[model samples]
Target: MGTPEVSRSPTKSPLTVSTSLTETVDGFHEFKIRSYSLTKGLGVGKFVASETFNVGDYTWAIYFYPDGKSPEDNSSYVSLFIALASEGADVRALFELTLVDQSGNGKHKVHSHFGRALESGPYTLKYRGSMW
Candidate 1:
């Protein structure tokens, strides 16, 4: 008989965060973001980013907070979402988020499956202009 195939998942993955500044309609700044995941054995893993973001010129950065959850008895996953605002604006931006592991490289990408946020809350914002 053929050997049974076994499957495994990533135990820990390296995450990279990237950001860009662009011009948007209504005199707002459009921030383009791209996040990368690097893996040793599987090579370059995954990348996630927003399609387009709208913010005020005074806005300094974007923040992403990840929450941990256990859906099954022992299976656990990480949930994530975004919060955005300017230094002076009293209002902030919040949205539902989801991630998926399409390539199965033990890395997760923002997609239809994987993890999601159940609610929203105030989050501290951090900004990085260049990639290292």
Candidate 2:
């Protein structure tokens, strides 16, 4: 009778990562464009920023691109963006950008990351990290 030899390989257990998220509506800011006409003529890719506001201990601003960011579009549409305007690292939050109707009909256009299911998660913004 003969005995068989077996070999063993060195291996480590798989590492697991866990993250818990606490969601809160930390802050809100309302911006108004008094004269929308004067905002034009800034040329493509240029933007006017709203006064800095605070949200979650971070400064924020709304950027209005009157002529849109795309030069080829030729002002076909206006672009608006929310930006993290202060010093921070990997700051995360949910946001809602809304265009309120002043006509008093109560209809509004809104782009939001609230009261809905997110495929990934909330957004993260670093210091001055924005397309605008």
Among these predictions, the greatest TM-score belongs to: 2
Pairs of residues at least 3 apart in sequence or in different chains that clash in candidate 2? none
Clashes of 2: 0
Model 1 regions more than 4 Å off: 1-52, 55-76, 92-94, 104-132
**Candidates' lDDT values, in order?**
0.35, 0.75
**Model 1 C-alpha lDDT per residue in residues 1-132, reported as the tens digit of each score:** 999998988688679899998443233333333332332122122223334355444333322222222234122333333434333344432332334454557774542112324254323344333111
C-alpha positional error of residue 53 in candidate 1 after TM-score superposition, expressed in Å? 3.9
Clashes of each: 1, 0
Model 2: how far is 89 from its true place, Å?
2.2
lDDT tens string, model 2, 1-132?
A: 789878878888999999998756568788887777787887889888789988766778898788887898598777778888786556777777787766779998876753444555678776674532
Model 1: ten consecutive residues of lowest lDDT: 38-47
Clashing pairs in 1: 99-113
